[model samples]
Target: MTTIAPSRPLTAAGYPRGFKWGVSTSSYQIEGGHDADGRLPSIWDTRCRMQGKIANGDTGDVACDHYHRYPEDIALMKGLGLDVYRFSVAWPRVLPKGKGRVNQKGLDFYDRLIDGVLEAGIEPWLCLYHWDLPQALDDLGGWPARDSAGWFADYAALCCQRYGDRVKHWATFNEFAVFTLFGYCIDWSAPGITDREAHLKAIHHVNLAHGMGVDVIRDLVPGAVVGAVHNRQVVWPEKDTDADRRAAALLDAHWNKAFPDPQLLGHYPDLIAESIAPYVKAGDMAQICRRTDWFGLNHYGPIFAKDDPNATWGFHWGAAPDDADKSDIGWPIWPAAFRDELIGLTKTYKLPIYVTENGMGGNDKVDDKGEVNDATRIRYLTLYTDAMKEAIAAGADVRGYYVWSLLDNFEWGTGYQNRFGLVHVDYETQKRTAKASYAWYRDYIKAARAAE
Candidate 1:
């Protein structure tokens, strides 16, 4: 007795057979009761205490209260006719000290969560780490510390040894670029630091941590499929000038290629070394080169670059030239660039790719009809899917598409202000209302299935 809209009468655009439709979410962003069931403080917990760090002084302490409402959430996913559920496991919850011991209660929660998803007939795509470094680890030098990599490996093994049988799809880390750059260099996120030296050190260690985690998971789960999640900005130049193009190349090296190069090519991007040479150590590159089963790209929008010597990162972002579609988040809705990114990565790495996260954030509210018909979000989803279809037709080995979120939850720093969910969550009442985007997506997938 699942609930969904009637399939629309429309011809389906050809997509690769067996292309998956799934929804994604993260631990800290959605799951509340931060200290419940033996969970301990994470770096995010400490960051939340810093005044002026988050908008509206928001914290994920009670986000969506998913800790108490997961069964209902799973039922909603079943209603969406989703094939997979991509979610993250909070590190501190499992390893309170980040390394020394395991908390049975913490592991029990995910054990139940996975079992529930499986009972709902949804494949579990578990992400090992998603920016929630245990507070104990941060106290021990955080990701910049070489020991943190080993600690992560231990934790990954622990999770796999326990739950690998039920979790078929695994992702090592989600968006290392955003965590390292925004958290360290920009000091905009948790455990904030703005030192260039710390940034480079954290970058190498994060890469090594990902590799070690993958190796551990592979050992524990003999048949588990592994990938690393990344949010890559498809960079574009503002003009045809050589300087602008050069800036775009640099932007791509830092934003898109840095995270994937070592895992796939056994080396960091050349421009990475050139840009951060002063802070690199002798054998850091060798430590980062670990093979992965797949490359997960979490693309949202493209960044237009122009040469700017005075810019903080030696590059500037320009607004999209054309405005055929735009999200309430002010992001351009360009589907063409999405295809280009897939093809670009395919040519560069020649590996299987999955669109791990893609969706639009909007100002959403239920109307008089008790319907959250967010037409703008629906349009964004359609155009983005069209982009994915084009890439598949062009022979890109793209495997699946997981929408950015399952529920409107705590968006970091912005807090609950930015809503990026197919289902809207009223923060006060904790009510789940499916939006127009959700209804449209259900129809789209059903049409695709009917066409098959």
Candidate 2:
């Protein structure tokens, strides 16, 4: 056991009064029932069906089975005393065909979900898209086509009409940067396509969709808490050399700043234009620069870069983080990098920020005592929370912190291999076990609530 040491108690006073504390999860990642209740095929549904992509040949076909077990999941959140619950609405469920006629069964699932969340005394922060675009939509060109923006807006309107009354916190999209880069650029995620032109086009359409979703929510729920959830990376150079600096700048522009620059700054970074102009079109920039209420930042590890003479556009490979530890996913657990990323955003955008997604993944296992006390995960949370406090002290207007997930479930391409949850899931039995980190977070919540 990693012993807990005596230290100054972390307090909410480190953040603004009424700062939100919550946990986040996505539908496809947790809500299994992939084929139940008229939930049609999403890109994830189709992708997981493709062999050799996901580990263990895992499909979300029965992921934590949250679809049939959400009441218990709500109880988990309630027990943790979380103030907010961030989750995504599976697009295919809302619009089975991705456009046109609505799927009442799909909408009804969210209706019950929102109601259940409200009854548990936790606010629902809904992400209109979590990259599980309906396979039907992908058949029609997916996010790369202009029509996707309109299709997403229509889906947004349907959701707003149904559950906008109780669910005030609305996130238009979650991590467009990851979707575009991983899905298209890297071809590692669902609906995978490896064309730079397709990637840039998809990125712009998602931005436009976010703006459109914001409009729909604002119109439906005038006092709605609407925002866009972007995964912001911290890009640092391996050295102070001019080449390294330029490489880091390119990485930052594309990975760290691309999504928010247009929405908040009213223009893509000049560097973004230069890097991606071959794929972008006239007037596309203007449409992507639409406004939003607040910015949701999902930060994890930092990247180190150095110039390469042989890479495309003078861009080069980024260094792996040097944090003492890495997650089961091989992602570095450098909490300070997260803090720095937030501070950088605050300085650049001057907007109210929410740490929308943060967590550590581990292959949690039960010990001889029939308990899964994950010391490493607890340490990750403590260090990360301390870093968040540091960011607040540095004058970042971070108003909330939502851990990446509440329970272990499907992890896209990695499937159920990497667990980034406070609660552990017994995939076979569909059982939920609160790991040591869960109790630690519960205690942290108690501390935060008492701090006020």
Q: Which candidate number maximizes lDDT?
A: 1
Q: In candidate 1, which residue ranges exceed 4 Å CA deviation?
A: 1-13, 237-247, 274-287, 306-312, 316-324
Mark the regions of model 2 whose C-alpha exceeds 4 Å error after superposition: 1-13, 237-247, 275-286, 305-324
| lDDT values, one for every candidate | 0.84, 0.81
Model 2 whole-model lDDT (C-alpha atoms) = 0.81
- Model 2, 20-111: lDDT tens per residue? 88999998999888888888899888888888888888998889888889999999999999999999999887787888878888788888
Question: For each candidate, what TM-score against the reference?
Answer: 0.92, 0.92
Lowest lDDT sum, 10 consecutive residues, model 2, at 1-10
